[model samples]
Target: MTGYRCEEFFGEGRRDAASVMAYETFVLENTDILDYLIKSDLIGETMKELLFVYKTLMKEGMLIHTGFDTDYEEMLYRYRNNEKDRVEFFEEVLDDIRKATGVNVRFCLWLCDSPQECLDSHNADQAKHLKEFEFDMYDTSDIVLADLGKKGKLCGYEKLPEASCSVQMENNL
Candidate 1:
Protein backbone atom coordinates (compact mmCIF):
# COMPACT_ATOMS: atom_id res chain seq x y z
CA MET A 1 0.00 0.00 0.00
CA THR A 2 1.12 3.53 -0.77
CA GLY A 3 0.05 6.95 0.40
CA TYR A 4 -2.82 8.60 -1.40
CA ARG A 5 -2.40 12.15 -2.65
CA CYS A 6 -4.59 15.15 -1.74
CA GLU A 7 -4.71 18.89 -2.32
CA GLU A 8 -6.71 20.81 0.25
CA PHE A 9 -8.65 24.03 -0.20
CA PHE A 10 -9.08 26.80 2.35
CA GLY A 11 -11.71 29.41 2.90
CA GLU A 12 -11.17 31.78 5.83
CA GLY A 13 -7.57 32.75 6.52
CA ARG A 14 -5.83 35.20 4.25
CA ARG A 15 -2.35 33.70 4.45
CA ASP A 16 -2.87 30.05 3.58
CA ALA A 17 -5.66 30.89 1.19
CA ALA A 18 -3.46 33.47 -0.50
CA SER A 19 -0.62 31.01 -0.77
CA VAL A 20 -2.78 28.28 -2.22
CA MET A 21 -4.50 30.77 -4.47
CA ALA A 22 -1.14 31.92 -5.76
CA TYR A 23 -0.12 28.39 -6.53
CA GLU A 24 -3.43 27.71 -8.25
CA THR A 25 -3.18 30.88 -10.30
CA PHE A 26 0.38 30.06 -11.26
CA VAL A 27 -0.53 26.55 -12.32
CA LEU A 28 -3.53 27.78 -14.28
CA GLU A 29 -1.64 30.48 -16.13
CA ASN A 30 1.84 29.02 -16.28
CA THR A 31 1.45 25.39 -17.26
CA ASP A 32 5.15 25.08 -17.90
CA ILE A 33 6.04 26.07 -14.36
CA LEU A 34 3.38 23.75 -13.02
CA ASP A 35 4.78 20.94 -15.13
CA TYR A 36 8.27 21.68 -13.91
CA LEU A 37 7.12 21.76 -10.29
CA ILE A 38 5.31 18.48 -10.69
CA LYS A 39 8.61 17.06 -11.84
CA SER A 40 10.54 18.72 -9.05
CA ASP A 41 10.77 17.95 -5.34
CA LEU A 42 10.41 21.58 -4.31
CA ILE A 43 6.67 21.62 -4.72
CA GLY A 44 5.94 17.92 -4.39
CA GLU A 45 7.72 17.80 -1.04
CA THR A 46 5.03 20.09 0.36
CA MET A 47 2.61 17.20 0.16
CA LYS A 48 2.16 15.92 3.71
CA GLU A 49 2.13 12.21 4.26
CA LEU A 50 0.29 10.13 6.87
CA LEU A 51 1.47 7.03 8.68
CA PHE A 52 -1.20 4.65 7.44
CA VAL A 53 -0.94 3.29 3.90
CA TYR A 54 -3.84 3.26 1.45
CA LYS A 55 -4.47 0.15 -0.59
CA THR A 56 -6.87 1.08 -3.37
CA LEU A 57 -8.45 -2.09 -4.71
CA MET A 58 -9.32 -0.34 -7.96
CA LYS A 59 -6.79 0.33 -10.70
CA GLU A 60 -7.67 3.99 -10.58
CA GLY A 61 -9.73 5.03 -7.60
CA MET A 62 -12.43 7.64 -7.92
CA LEU A 63 -12.39 10.66 -5.60
CA ILE A 64 -15.73 12.19 -4.70
CA HIS A 65 -16.57 15.52 -3.10
CA THR A 66 -19.69 14.84 -1.06
CA GLY A 67 -19.81 18.05 0.86
CA PHE A 68 -22.42 20.08 2.74
CA ASP A 69 -25.99 18.82 2.87
CA THR A 70 -25.02 15.46 1.36
CA ASP A 71 -25.76 16.85 -2.08
CA TYR A 72 -23.99 13.95 -3.74
CA GLU A 73 -26.86 11.63 -3.00
CA GLU A 74 -29.44 14.04 -4.44
CA MET A 75 -27.20 14.85 -7.40
CA LEU A 76 -26.89 11.18 -8.26
CA TYR A 77 -30.61 10.67 -7.95
CA ARG A 78 -31.29 13.58 -10.27
CA TYR A 79 -28.68 12.52 -12.81
CA ARG A 80 -30.14 9.05 -12.98
CA ASN A 81 -33.55 10.54 -13.46
CA ASN A 82 -32.30 12.40 -16.50
CA GLU A 83 -29.26 10.88 -18.14
CA LYS A 84 -28.95 13.57 -20.82
CA ASP A 85 -28.86 16.33 -18.24
CA ARG A 86 -26.33 14.30 -16.31
CA VAL A 87 -23.99 14.08 -19.29
CA GLU A 88 -24.12 17.81 -19.84
CA PHE A 89 -23.62 18.51 -16.16
CA PHE A 90 -20.61 16.22 -15.98
CA GLU A 91 -19.15 17.69 -19.13
CA GLU A 92 -19.45 21.07 -17.50
CA VAL A 93 -17.59 19.83 -14.42
CA LEU A 94 -14.79 18.42 -16.56
CA ASP A 95 -14.58 21.63 -18.51
CA ASP A 96 -14.56 23.70 -15.33
CA ILE A 97 -11.76 21.59 -13.88
CA ARG A 98 -9.77 21.76 -17.08
CA LYS A 99 -10.32 25.49 -17.26
CA ALA A 100 -9.08 25.82 -13.71
CA THR A 101 -6.22 23.29 -13.78
CA GLY A 102 -5.27 23.12 -17.48
CA VAL A 103 -5.46 19.36 -17.32
CA ASN A 104 -7.66 16.69 -18.89
CA VAL A 105 -8.56 14.11 -16.30
CA ARG A 106 -11.06 11.30 -16.76
CA PHE A 107 -14.67 11.82 -15.76
CA CYS A 108 -15.95 9.36 -13.21
CA LEU A 109 -19.53 10.02 -12.23
CA TRP A 110 -19.51 10.13 -8.44
CA LEU A 111 -23.05 8.72 -8.35
CA CYS A 112 -22.77 8.89 -4.58
CA ASP A 113 -20.13 6.28 -5.16
CA SER A 114 -16.77 5.04 -3.96
CA PRO A 115 -14.48 2.42 -5.44
CA GLN A 116 -15.76 -0.57 -3.46
CA GLU A 117 -19.45 0.14 -3.03
CA CYS A 118 -21.65 -0.38 -6.07
CA LEU A 119 -25.35 -0.34 -5.30
CA ASP A 120 -26.70 -3.84 -5.13
CA SER A 121 -29.17 -5.92 -3.16
CA HIS A 122 -32.78 -6.99 -3.34
CA ASN A 123 -34.29 -4.41 -1.02
CA ALA A 124 -34.74 -0.89 -2.38
CA ASP A 125 -34.23 0.76 1.00
CA GLN A 126 -30.81 2.38 1.55
CA ALA A 127 -30.98 3.31 5.21
CA LYS A 128 -28.44 0.88 6.63
CA HIS A 129 -26.02 0.76 3.73
CA LEU A 130 -22.34 1.52 3.98
CA LYS A 131 -21.22 3.88 1.27
CA GLU A 132 -19.19 2.00 -1.32
CA PHE A 133 -16.15 4.17 -0.91
CA GLU A 134 -14.88 4.92 2.55
CA PHE A 135 -11.69 6.09 0.87
CA ASP A 136 -13.12 9.37 -0.37
CA MET A 137 -12.64 12.83 1.10
CA TYR A 138 -14.62 16.03 1.33
CA ASP A 139 -13.40 19.16 -0.36
CA THR A 140 -12.21 21.38 2.47
CA SER A 141 -14.73 23.90 3.68
CA ASP A 142 -14.54 27.68 3.50
CA ILE A 143 -12.77 27.34 6.85
CA VAL A 144 -9.05 27.15 7.40
CA LEU A 145 -7.31 25.84 10.47
CA ALA A 146 -5.03 28.89 10.43
CA ASP A 147 -3.34 28.17 13.75
CA LEU A 148 -1.97 24.87 12.45
CA GLY A 149 0.16 26.69 9.88
CA LYS A 150 2.24 28.50 12.51
CA LYS A 151 5.04 26.03 11.81
CA GLY A 152 4.48 26.05 8.06
CA LYS A 153 1.94 23.29 7.97
CA LEU A 154 0.16 23.12 4.61
CA CYS A 155 -2.74 20.78 5.27
CA GLY A 156 -2.50 21.07 8.98
CA TYR A 157 -0.82 17.68 9.11
CA GLU A 158 1.35 18.81 11.99
CA LYS A 159 -0.03 18.39 15.50
CA LEU A 160 -2.25 21.18 16.76
CA PRO A 161 -3.01 21.85 20.42
CA GLU A 162 -6.82 21.44 20.24
CA ALA A 163 -7.28 19.14 17.30
CA SER A 164 -10.56 17.55 16.41
CA CYS A 165 -11.25 14.10 14.96
CA SER A 166 -11.80 15.72 11.55
CA VAL A 167 -8.18 16.84 11.56
CA GLN A 168 -6.96 13.33 12.14
CA MET A 169 -9.46 11.99 9.63
CA GLU A 170 -8.30 14.36 6.91
CA ASN A 171 -4.67 13.34 7.37
CA ASN A 172 -5.50 9.63 7.41
CA LEU A 173 -7.67 10.03 4.32
Candidate 2:
Protein backbone atom coordinates (compact mmCIF):
# COMPACT_ATOMS: atom_id res chain seq x y z
CA MET A 1 0.00 0.00 0.00
CA THR A 2 1.00 3.60 -0.29
CA GLY A 3 1.99 5.97 2.48
CA TYR A 4 -1.13 7.85 1.59
CA ARG A 5 -3.13 4.86 2.67
CA CYS A 6 -1.36 4.84 6.03
CA GLU A 7 -1.86 8.56 6.32
CA GLU A 8 -5.55 8.09 5.81
CA PHE A 9 -5.90 5.86 8.83
CA PHE A 10 -4.11 8.29 11.10
CA GLY A 11 -5.99 11.35 9.96
CA GLU A 12 -8.96 10.72 12.17
CA GLY A 13 -9.61 12.79 15.27
CA ARG A 14 -8.72 11.62 18.75
CA ARG A 15 -9.74 8.04 19.43
CA ASP A 16 -11.16 6.59 22.59
CA ALA A 17 -9.33 3.97 24.65
CA ALA A 18 -11.71 1.24 23.57
CA SER A 19 -11.16 2.27 19.99
CA VAL A 20 -7.40 2.10 20.41
CA MET A 21 -7.54 -1.36 21.95
CA ALA A 22 -9.83 -2.61 19.25
CA TYR A 23 -7.56 -1.20 16.59
CA GLU A 24 -4.55 -2.92 18.12
CA THR A 25 -6.47 -6.18 18.34
CA PHE A 26 -7.44 -5.86 14.71
CA VAL A 27 -3.84 -5.30 13.72
CA LEU A 28 -2.82 -8.31 15.76
CA GLU A 29 -5.50 -10.59 14.33
CA ASN A 30 -5.76 -9.69 10.65
CA THR A 31 -2.23 -8.81 9.61
CA ASP A 32 -0.14 -11.67 8.34
CA ILE A 33 2.88 -9.69 9.36
CA LEU A 34 3.19 -11.54 12.64
CA ASP A 35 1.26 -14.74 12.09
CA TYR A 36 2.95 -15.52 8.81
CA LEU A 37 6.32 -15.46 10.43
CA ILE A 38 5.20 -17.21 13.58
CA LYS A 39 2.76 -19.78 12.24
CA SER A 40 2.55 -20.20 8.49
CA ASP A 41 6.04 -19.75 7.00
CA LEU A 42 7.88 -21.63 9.76
CA ILE A 43 9.95 -18.74 11.03
CA GLY A 44 10.24 -17.34 14.54
CA GLU A 45 7.02 -17.88 16.51
CA THR A 46 7.74 -16.15 19.77
CA MET A 47 6.02 -13.26 21.51
CA LYS A 48 9.45 -11.72 21.17
CA GLU A 49 8.33 -10.16 17.94
CA LEU A 50 5.37 -8.48 19.60
CA LEU A 51 7.34 -7.52 22.67
CA PHE A 52 10.19 -6.18 20.60
CA VAL A 53 7.82 -3.99 18.68
CA TYR A 54 6.00 -2.73 21.76
CA LYS A 55 9.22 -2.07 23.62
CA THR A 56 10.69 -0.31 20.64
CA LEU A 57 7.59 1.79 20.24
CA MET A 58 7.68 2.66 23.91
CA LYS A 59 11.34 3.49 23.70
CA GLU A 60 10.96 5.63 20.60
CA GLY A 61 8.46 7.73 22.50
CA MET A 62 5.81 7.63 19.78
CA LEU A 63 3.47 5.85 22.13
CA ILE A 64 0.81 8.05 23.56
CA HIS A 65 0.40 7.92 27.29
CA THR A 66 -3.29 7.34 27.27
CA GLY A 67 -3.85 5.17 30.33
CA PHE A 68 -4.44 1.98 28.38
CA ASP A 69 -4.38 -0.28 31.40
CA THR A 70 -8.01 0.32 32.22
CA ASP A 71 -8.95 -0.12 28.63
CA TYR A 72 -7.05 -3.37 28.42
CA GLU A 73 -8.65 -4.64 31.57
CA GLU A 74 -12.10 -3.88 30.27
CA MET A 75 -11.38 -5.53 26.96
CA LEU A 76 -9.96 -8.57 28.65
CA TYR A 77 -13.06 -8.85 30.76
CA ARG A 78 -15.28 -8.63 27.73
CA TYR A 79 -13.21 -11.20 25.90
CA ARG A 80 -13.24 -13.57 28.83
CA ASN A 81 -16.93 -13.10 29.37
CA ASN A 82 -17.60 -13.99 25.74
CA GLU A 83 -19.24 -10.64 25.21
CA LYS A 84 -16.84 -9.49 22.51
CA ASP A 85 -18.02 -9.83 18.95
CA ARG A 86 -15.30 -10.43 16.39
CA VAL A 87 -17.08 -8.51 13.65
CA GLU A 88 -17.98 -5.71 15.97
CA PHE A 89 -14.46 -5.65 17.34
CA PHE A 90 -13.07 -5.18 13.87
CA GLU A 91 -15.62 -2.54 13.06
CA GLU A 92 -14.64 -0.63 16.16
CA VAL A 93 -11.03 -0.89 15.04
CA LEU A 94 -11.89 0.55 11.67
CA ASP A 95 -13.78 3.34 13.31
CA ASP A 96 -10.84 4.00 15.57
CA ILE A 97 -8.53 4.13 12.58
CA ARG A 98 -10.77 6.63 10.88
CA LYS A 99 -10.79 8.77 13.96
CA ALA A 100 -7.10 8.47 14.73
CA THR A 101 -5.67 8.64 11.23
CA GLY A 102 -8.51 10.12 9.24
CA VAL A 103 -8.07 7.42 6.63
CA ASN A 104 -9.66 4.05 6.18
CA VAL A 105 -7.12 1.24 6.47
CA ARG A 106 -7.17 -2.18 4.96
CA PHE A 107 -5.03 -5.28 5.41
CA CYS A 108 -3.84 -8.06 3.11
CA LEU A 109 -2.96 -11.17 4.97
CA TRP A 110 0.04 -13.15 3.71
CA LEU A 111 2.36 -15.93 4.79
CA CYS A 112 5.87 -14.57 4.69
CA ASP A 113 8.69 -13.17 6.79
CA SER A 114 9.73 -9.81 5.37
CA PRO A 115 8.47 -7.23 2.89
CA GLN A 116 10.20 -9.25 0.20
CA GLU A 117 8.56 -12.37 1.56
CA CYS A 118 5.19 -10.67 1.45
CA LEU A 119 5.79 -9.77 -2.18
CA ASP A 120 6.81 -13.32 -2.93
CA SER A 121 3.74 -14.65 -1.20
CA HIS A 122 1.58 -12.26 -3.15
CA ASN A 123 3.14 -13.43 -6.38
CA ALA A 124 2.80 -17.09 -5.47
CA ASP A 125 -0.81 -16.61 -4.53
CA GLN A 126 -1.41 -15.20 -7.99
CA ALA A 127 -2.13 -11.90 -6.29
CA LYS A 128 -5.54 -13.16 -5.33
CA HIS A 129 -5.51 -11.46 -1.93
CA LEU A 130 -4.01 -8.30 -3.33
CA LYS A 131 -6.43 -8.21 -6.22
CA GLU A 132 -9.36 -8.43 -3.89
CA PHE A 133 -8.15 -5.70 -1.58
CA GLU A 134 -5.73 -2.85 -1.04
CA PHE A 135 -3.72 -2.95 2.15
CA ASP A 136 -0.61 -1.39 3.55
CA MET A 137 2.10 -3.83 4.50
CA TYR A 138 3.00 -3.68 8.14
CA ASP A 139 6.20 -5.15 9.55
CA THR A 140 5.74 -5.52 13.27
CA SER A 141 9.43 -5.30 14.01
CA ASP A 142 9.94 -2.32 11.80
CA ILE A 143 6.80 -0.67 13.07
CA VAL A 144 8.02 -0.96 16.65
CA LEU A 145 11.36 0.52 15.79
CA ALA A 146 9.90 3.26 13.66
CA ASP A 147 7.24 4.17 16.21
CA LEU A 148 9.83 4.35 18.95
CA GLY A 149 12.22 6.34 16.82
CA LYS A 150 9.39 8.57 15.72
CA LYS A 151 8.69 9.35 19.36
CA GLY A 152 12.39 10.00 20.03
CA LYS A 153 12.57 6.97 22.32
CA LEU A 154 15.22 5.04 20.43
CA CYS A 155 17.56 6.02 23.20
CA GLY A 156 16.28 2.89 24.96
CA TYR A 157 17.85 0.77 22.27
CA GLU A 158 20.97 2.84 22.51
CA LYS A 159 21.07 2.16 26.24
CA LEU A 160 21.06 -1.57 25.65
CA PRO A 161 24.43 -3.27 25.45
CA GLU A 162 25.61 -4.48 22.07
CA ALA A 163 26.53 -7.83 23.59
CA SER A 164 26.72 -9.50 26.96
CA CYS A 165 29.83 -11.42 27.98
CA SER A 166 31.48 -12.45 31.21
CA VAL A 167 35.19 -12.13 31.90
CA GLN A 168 35.65 -15.32 33.85
CA MET A 169 39.39 -15.33 33.42
CA GLU A 170 39.66 -11.78 34.64
CA ASN A 171 37.50 -12.63 37.61
CA ASN A 172 39.82 -15.50 38.50
CA LEU A 173 42.84 -13.25 38.08
The best candidate in terms of lDDT: 2
lDDT: worst 10-residue window of model 1:
50-59
Q: How accurate is candidate 1 locally (lDDT)?
A: 0.26
lDDT of 1 by residue, 1-173 (tens): 11111112222222222233233322232222223323433222222110000011011222243542334434433443554554454344334434444544231111111121212211213323432212323232211212121111222111221212121121211
User: What is the C-alpha lDDT profile of model 2 across 24-125, one tens digit per residue?
Assistant: 434333232222222322223244354244334434444334444444334433432343553355344334434544544332211122323323333334
TM-score of each: 0.21, 0.24
Give the C-alpha miss distance for residue 123 in model 1, angstroms.
15
TM-score of 1: 0.21
Cα displacement (angstroms), candidate 2, residue 34, comes to 12
